[model samples]
Target chain A: MSLRLAVLGAGAVGGSVLDLAGDYGHDVVAFADSSSSAVDPAGLDPSAVHDRKEREGVVGDADPEAVFDADYDVLVEATPTTLGDAEPGFSHVERALGDDRHVVLANKGPVAERYADLRALEAESAGTVQFEAAVGGAIPVLSTISDLGAPHVTAARGVLNGTANFILSRMAAEGLDYEHVLAEAQDLGVAEADPTFDVDGIDAALKFVILANVLSDGKTEYALDDAEVEGIRNVPGTALDLAAEDGRTVRLIGEATADGVRVAPRLVPQGSALSVTGTQNIVQLETKHAGQLNISGRGAGGPETATAVLSDVSRLE
Target chain B: MSLRLAVLGAGAVGGSVLDLAGDYGHDVVAFADSSSSAVDPAGLDPSAVHDRKEREGVVGDADPEAVFDADYDVLVEATPTTLGDAEPGFSHVERALGDDRHVVLANKGPVAERYADLRALEAESAGTVQFEAAVGGAIPVLSTISDLGAPHVTAARGVLNGTANFILSRMAAEGLDYEHVLAEAQDLGVAEADPTFDVDGIDAALKFVILANVLSDGKTEYALDDAEVEGIRNVPGTALDLAAEDGRTVRLIGEATADGVRVAPRLVPQGSALSVTGTQNIVQLETKHAGQLNISGRGAGGPETATAVLSDVSRLE
Candidate 1:
């Protein structure tokens, strides 16, 4: 069951996947960053690739297009996420699917924006598509939904963004304003230089859009525009203080159902499972017969998201 | 993918399975109680069977042993769990496997007490074994482990028994003694007349033993005797008040790993995910690569447990 993988994107997630693929009984035959490519049909050494990427700012000497020529079974797409047409990542997925090679995605762009197009491509190909890493990092949310069968799951809602959740939970805990906490988060590397995506609810919204698409089961296609998103920036310190006084707290929660997708900062009971602390994520599924199912975990990080990607790779086998 | 189901045990879980099997596009071809049995080559009406059982205290006039004579694709075992030897349930499972029929279990006895024997029988039979309902009732704990591959999961722990959790949380919430809460829970039908199985941690211990067996994957076999069990009856109201003042709460928690299984009342942070109140249950898995995964939901009920059984039946298909 060892699969030959051609991984795109040498960022944290892709690099970690390359590092851990062998541990899961898989081989990395081809790898690519934005500007360079590394191809070895005999299987590339992870450490060697890491060393070259660090010292030379490039994975290897080959052209980036060479990845398409490499003989591989599964294509691992961990590239940076982009909105709109979800280009580059979408095209990469299309090429892989067109070749009848299985595609495992960590990029949320294509899945959140172009689900119908992606699924249509998959429908025509021999290879299947899986994107467990695109949602709640290492939490098996999609697989659980698949196991329960989408029709039985009535609704899904959760804290999907770790950065936003971390900021909000920290604000509630310390009674700090948005500016102060965002600055501290930036210093701690928890928030990116431009934290618009994480703080403004787009990241969480995209994950919920993907969930809505999955739950809808091709009956209705959902995109980012369909969601009504509200971020953590608007949640004031006074609001959190008042909530805490009432034994409640504010959390950036995203909800998806047959109706639509919505992400907003909402109040929850202080001791509730949804009120998970810094950098944690939780998804609550309302099942038709099984009652509520809550799954929470570290929804981000290199090794964590990589574990999800590798899990998807194993499923392909 | 319509499966002919032969349901045993006319209790809550089995009766619910017979009632809802049709909703999942399956047919109950045969059903039995301890004293009576019903067989139909086509399908038995759920309401008619329920009415007969309600009126006459039996499912049908046929002998209980006649269930073995019916043609079934899968055998649903929801009988009362027995600790030592796990008898009657074990024999029913053995008969079904001997007949080369798939066995989906809601009985924890055969799984927790006789895992090795059950797996050994499965090794020789063409039919596979699945017991999702045996662990966390409705929550998808075992399937998550299966999807992640048990080797990737390092350890598992959780609040499993709902009756104990309800009593403990009520005591902690209302500052009431265990006796008072136990009486209230019994009156509310949350705890059984003899709540020893749940309150004494035996029930949670059985679940963790089954988890230990699954995580160990045949390297070792675990039974109820192997677990270090401690009940919640000794958790005083004063202790709960002290812990709550310190922003912590006591919960009847169960932990399972390669080392062993332990079920005892443990203190957790008041706002922590593990401090789920009321009858809710949660299992946290510590994965090797992925950080930590928490899955919580209804751990027991007629329809909830039946949903798990039907989910297993779907997997078999």
Candidate 2:
């Protein structure tokens, strides 16, 4: 049961998959960057990760020829999260899944936008594509939903965007404004220069889509295009003050619950998990069996998410 | 594949277990409540739960024994957390396990203090004594640990006691002292009149013991007694204010990273799941394969815990 994995677009997440594959000592087929350097189809050593890093852009440079010719059993999609088009990793995931590669996605694009295609592709291939890393870095949420009893999950909700939560926490605690927090987040590389996805609820919305599909087993209907998106930009420093009026707090919860599905900044009073996690993204599910379950942690950062990618790779073993 | 179930000391949790069982149409045999109503080996009917309120020492007056004797497949131990040698659940859990009946425990005391005896009994019977509902209400953490791919989990950590978390949440928000919060929690029945196990970290320590034994297959060397059991009984408002100064909140995290095991109220800068769960209990686990995972909700309500019992019953089906 040794799997030969070919990782596409070796960026932060892609490189993570590669590093994990190397660490796990799985058989890695080749390195195919779209730029700079490429490995011939003979298969490259996963051990050469350090050397590959030394040659900047040599991994995520995206060389399809090498990727197509790899002796790999699965393709790990770890390209950057493009806004809508699934740009860098979307097409790569489609090709890998189409080419009979069992897919494990740490990338946010493919399953976020083109989930239907991936579902159909998995059905057609009779293989599987696991994307638990999409929402909460290393949370076993997706698998928990799928493998648990045939549950009729009503809604999947949580604080999906880690960067947004940090901003809110700062706003609540230090009384800092959104701009100040966003500037720091971007400078720290925690938020992108164009942080529309993280801020405007798009990222959380994407995760909700993944959860809905998994919880409902692709039969539950959801409206992706009509997601009620709201950013933390409008959150007030006085929101925490208002929360203090009732021994409560404010949290930006992106959820799909019984009232259909929604992503909103909620006024959660005291006596909830929402107020404890200062900057960690906590994802929760409300179902028929379990009323409400909270899952929390650092939803971003390299070590945590990199460890998550490694966990996915470990699943192959 | 029928199981002989005997429910011992039918309280809220025990009665709720049988209530959920009746809904699923499970067969129960010999509900052993020391109450005056137990001459025949009749299965308890969970529907007429209100009838227990009708008479003194009449436990199963709720639903007329739904199933007659000799129909159960297991025994359920849902007694209160007894302390020291006066332990009540100890006898029942030990008896059921010895009887080769699959045991489901919601009690933490008998397992925590007398872990060796319970484990020996279970080993002798070669029967599983499940306790998913023991640790966190409806979280499925124990089951998740049991099902994980890694044979040796590097660590298992969580907010195991809902009452303690609830008290901490009050202290964090209302700036209320621990004594005040403790009294309130006891009034709400969240904590016992003598709330030592929860506030002193004994309850979480007990759950940790069970997890270490079962998930690690009883091979790991870890002493919960040595854990830095810092309770939330003496949290200073100054600490909360200082945490607020740094844009942070405080939470009692039972963490077992490479840094070793500890249970203390740590300062968490906002945007974390711990921060968000104001009074509810949220649990997270870091496993070898799953990385960091989380689960949150009402960790100690009758309905929520009852739901956890239902989850177990569903699995039995």
Instruction: Encode model 1's per-residue lDDT on B1-317: one tens digit a residue.
Output: 99999999989999999988988999999999999999998999999999999998999989999988999999999999999999999999999999999999999999999999999999999999999999989999999999888999999999999999999999998999999999999999999999999999999999999999999999999999999999998999999999999999999999998889999999998868788888888999999988889999999999999999999999987
Candidate 1 lDDT over A1-317, as tens digits, reads: 99999999999999999999998999999999999999999899999999999999999999888999999999999999999999989999999999999999999999999999999999999999999999999989999998898999999998999999889988988989999999999999999999999999999999999999999999999999999999988889999999999999999999999889999999998868788888989999999999899999989998999999998999887
In model 2, state the lDDT of residue A112.
Answer: 66
**Candidate 1 stretches greater than 4 Å from native:** none
lDDT of 1 at B98: 97
DockQ of each: 0.83, 0.27
Which DockQ value does candidate 1 get? 0.83
- CA RMSD (A), model 2: 6.0
Q: Whose lDDT is greatest here?
A: 1
List, residue by residue over B1-317, the lDDT tens digit for candidate 2. 33445566566676665555554445555554544323234554554433653555565443323312334566666667765642667776665566566777777766655666677788888566667777777776765554444352567766777777778777777887788888988998888988888888777766666555555554443445645678777777678777877878777777654444578777875655556444466566665543566666666655567666655655554
| lDDT over C-alpha atoms for residue B202 of model 1 | 98
